[model samples]
Target: MANYTDWNQALIDYFIKGTPHGTKIYLSVDEDVIERIGYHFGQSSTNVIWVNDFCIAVRIKVIFEGQVNLQHLKGRDSQGLPKGVAFLCATILAASQMAQEEKTSETNYFKRLREILALDGFARPLGMKFGNEAEEPLWREWNRWLMEDRFLPSAQRGGGAATYINYPISQSLLRRTDKDRLRKLFQEKQWQAEWDAQTLFAHVRREAGAFGIHLKDLLTENKQRHEAIVEALHQVYEQWKAQGCPTADKNNYCTWSRHLFCGLYRTEEPFLGQVDYYLYPKQQRGRSLESVEVKQGDNLHLLREERPGWYFPLEYSVSQKELDNGAKYQISSPNDLDYLILPARDFWILIPDAENPDSGAYASWQAPSLGTEFILLCKQELVSDIERLRDEHLLKSSCTPQPIFNNSGWVELQQCMVVSQAWDGVFIKNQALKDALQPSVKLLISFSGGLRVPKIGAWLVNHGPQITIFGFYSTAELKVTRLSDNQIILESSQSTNTSIRLDFSDPGHYLIEATFAGESSQRLVKIVDWDELAIEKYVHPEVMAINSEYHIFGSVIGQIF
Candidate 1:
């Protein structure tokens, strides 16, 4: 294996091939210069063939590390100012100011690039403007944030520098599973105990944000983007391995993007749901009902007495028209009602868009459905509360069977059981599994007590959501082992077809190894405890609907939804 020094040397030697890389290296970890005779051993030294080059690298690290002194900008002696900081100040500089500032005055480095979104040109005018910087408030804000060291580099803070966000670093920072892989590759242990790799990473992130650079997002999205990308990559790699690992040098020149197999770790994403709702923004205007405008400073509050278990966070809009007595009032944004969205559930989330096969009321956001636009969101652990809400008559009338948004394209809303595991080392032990992964040769191992799979939480979390048996199949050896302890639970020397339903009495994460020819493919499997999984998966609880006119306060009664 190539040592850490070889890797770092390659990054610097190969990446800084052009002027663009030279200009951008300040934003890269490659600029962190350190010299040692024995790999990651030995004391740090600045000895270098080119003194100026070493100086440049040192300077790049300092600025991004957030120790930038604004006053130092004026003290630099003419070698084109600090390289990185200067470029940033230039991008946002007012043209008039740029012209007035002295060329030798310190200014260097462009902040991380921000994408310019071209708005509706058809609806508005476009024009060109010039200056030391455009009057972009966003840039100003980023400038301030990146210039500080207060920002932490942990998962909560954007994990990577703005320039490198989305590029490996931030991706690792966003995902818990990616951290160990990155740390191992970077030889991060050499970092000072206090100013450790993580701390320095935070420093880089802090400075990037202070500079008003747009940090790429990982959490803003309800569904993660990386999971799908990794999954697809794994599938491709498996197919390639099963086909004999063809290479371009062998006259193959086939298309393939190779990715290192990072070890898999359990990952559980929170299940959440959102639905549009209506409410009275202001305090109840009992009996003497009259419309009142919610002022700019008005605080919207939810009536707690109305629903005991459900807590309403102020989130909706009201309409101007009168509540036209209609059964399905939640669908239309009538001028008569206030509109709002229900908060998403943090855990056990059951989005109720239940349209009774018989209820005369029908209300929908966009999907074809009818009922009060109510979603039942409760902690998965809150079994009693979830049960009570499911049984509530008023809630049943509001929340109904509706379309749930799942960006992952997984078959249905899955329970938090069976968390996702990061990529693991896949050993192609069989010839068919090595370089000839037939899409038809999929090895599916399902769990069932006997031969029959239980519908109880088994189907949703343990197996059957994705059908891998698309191509012809060959006999492959199958082994199921308990991951928590590495105990071999079951083993079969030969299995035909693409699917095999294996019974697993115990619940937890497992490792399923399927071997074809001589190669074997392994991936993580999570078998959630039936008890815990049952709560997340729906168990058809009875709920009554109170479809009638309701009162707002003690004195006022109106057709409120």
Candidate 2:
């Protein structure tokens, strides 16, 4: 008679050869052995029947006929069988015992088998390819069971849904020792179904540590950091809401904060702390306009910064109509009233008038909820003009405006003053005065004093006929060159306040060039005859002729009155 181990090996050998369809095998053994084997076969398959207690009849069904194939183990002479075969035998035994107590469907039978295999760490050794069509559904069902059992810890929870961290419970990472301990706990029903998130996490933490797993590296630290960031952002949101939820647009503040929280939560860095909020069109006490520098692009400005990198801007712009009507800005309509989120090193807060704190219409405006350190307020009309100029390369990236001439400069004719005011406002309305001061009439241009020449260079005056230029300079040089003839009309070097004169005896264009310090500047001068003035047609009674050869400020002043 064969011993128990011999009978077990014989059964394994029979299955290894592959079960054939409609085949029956009879084995004669003791009552105890026959009863045990008969019970297991009856539970696992319907082909087993009792042919007296001493002998049993077994038949392979069509569905499971060719499923068992362990021919690779034919020549193995090892004392102990492989874990996979041991697990298969143990599964049949356990199923037999379970089936006798409670009947289950085929689907439940497969699920129970998978659970046993997974708990014993024999799933991988059994070479079960989840990619196989027959195994795909079972694998999915296994995953579903894991989720339902709360074996995975929650990473985040909100909106009646939760995301779980599955790495700690991944099947591929499970060790035999770990699986054994887990299997014991599961069989003992140590886990409670009513456990909360904290309680579940505590259990997971303890088990993970006993399993030689690093919870901190996998999930604990990340989860804790995420929670802390969410809390911090929540506080910030509350404060922002308390402040009326100021934004460049109606809903943009909340939207931007949501995006910010998401980005900050995923990162390893700490939250944004101690942000400085600045409002545009609001007077900054003791801050001078000279401290801000205008850039070429629309809404681009710079300021002196001690900590440059931390400076950022949340800028808003509005159309002329909106500004006048006091309409709120919107991010959707970029051309009308819009907002921009930009990362910058420096920025400016532009008010209507820097000298008058109360001049700005948006003076009472509040800061944005995100706490902007840089902000700008610009008219809508100017925004397009700035963009156009920038596209055309007409504006330099960085430049300082320079005054070329003083307000006191005047134009004269034959030593008689013709105009002594800004040219923009001067117009010739009196024909008598216009004909008297024609281009044919010899003219003289004079710069009396206070010529606001830039310290780096001299002013280039483009004038017609004789002209006298006077200014106070510590040390300067003046030069006049005829462009047509390339002839130097006059060149002078002086160390004190001096006067320079150039004479144009004929009608043509002359180049007036000057140098101060180490820099030089030049202008074109056009001299014309009196007949070229077109005095009769240009000189009008009602119209203010700014195109006249000679601008008479006296007439314009009279006309204004």
Could you give candidate 2's per-residue lDDT for residues 1-561 as a string of tens digits? 223244345444433222111111111122222333444434554444321321211111001232422333222236543212222233343333233223334333444444433323223223333233323332233222222221111111112111111111121112223323444443354332322122233344444444333322232333212322222223233223333444312222111111110000001112642112232221111112223332323444443331111112223332223322322222332222123222121111211211122322212121111111112332222334333333443222222221111331111111112221122233333222221121221111233222122221122233333334322235546566665577887777643233444456555545554556433333345455544443334545444445544343634523333
Q: TM-score for model 2?
A: 0.18
RMSD of each: 26.2, 37.3
Worst 10 residues of 2 by lDDT: 259-268
- Runs off by more than 4 Å, candidate 1: 1-471, 494-499, 517-520, 526-561
How many residue pairs collide in each prediction? 80, 1
lDDT of 1 by residue, 378-464 (tens): 222333333333343212323222322233111112221111111123322221111111111123332222221232222333432
How far residue 198's Cα lies from its native spot in candidate 2, in Å, is 58
